[model samples]
Target: MKYEADSPEAYIDLLPEDRQEPIRRLRKCILSNLPEGFEETMSYGMIGYVVPHSKYPAGYHCNPELPLPFLNIASQKNFIAFYHSGIYADPELKAWFVEAYRERVPTKLDMGKSCIRFKKPEHIPYELLGALCRKISVSDWIQLYEEKISR
Candidate 1:
């Protein structure tokens, strides 16, 4: 579901009461473990963690005016979605996450290239997500973005 909000707080407020807490926890997990320099904002209608234009002057390759997005979390129609650009860009990172997720969670992983969908909020693995957040730093993301995604 696409929510129209100006800020992360507003986005959370717009979610259903049942979804708010899980999204809040997910947001906290990302913020607590995410390395320095990524800024939180509303990007593509979700709560986005991004490399601000101040840090990456060229901004996002698709749209230069917007910040370069690193991660995003959203409450979707059928599930909660956690999007991490690093896993999509880095094969080694993706493999590590896939293996780690299997070790930590009993359920089958419902994942796309960058989006991991949690059908049941209770099944959302906060610890694994936090570790994933820490796996890439701002400079490292910029380098990977340029090399693999931005072209």
Candidate 2:
């Protein structure tokens, strides 16, 4: 997906009408469980929740101007995707996410290192998604990001 909006709200608005409801529901799930200090914004051509520059002045190690990305939700070419940085870093969390997803949804989980792709809104594992979102805080993510770059 191409970068379009400068803000989260704008990003939501730009989504196709059919994609809007699912994305909005997922967005609500994300926002409601998000920890303090994470800021929602448009990043990497998606709706992103990130550790703000104010919270970590060094910003993302890969690009200093960009804030550290924590999670993102995007309507892709064929699927709605959820990107979770914490799950990529923590093997334990990844395993747990996979297990929880299987327990919650009958469909096989479609996932990568950090991205979970769902074909439709009905396929979303909302509870597991919210739990994943709540698993890491802004400070925790900064620490994890720091550790990752150092290694």
Candidate with maximal TM-score: 1
Per-candidate clash tally:
0, 0
Best by lDDT: 1
Q: Give the TM-score of candidate 1.
A: 0.99
TM-score of each: 0.99, 0.94
Model 2, position 126: C-alpha lDDT score: 85
RMSD of 2: 1.3
- For candidate 1, write residues 79-103 as lDDT tens digits: 9999999999999999999999999
Local error of candidate 2 at residue 124 (angstroms): 0.5
Per-residue lDDT value at 36 in model 1: 100
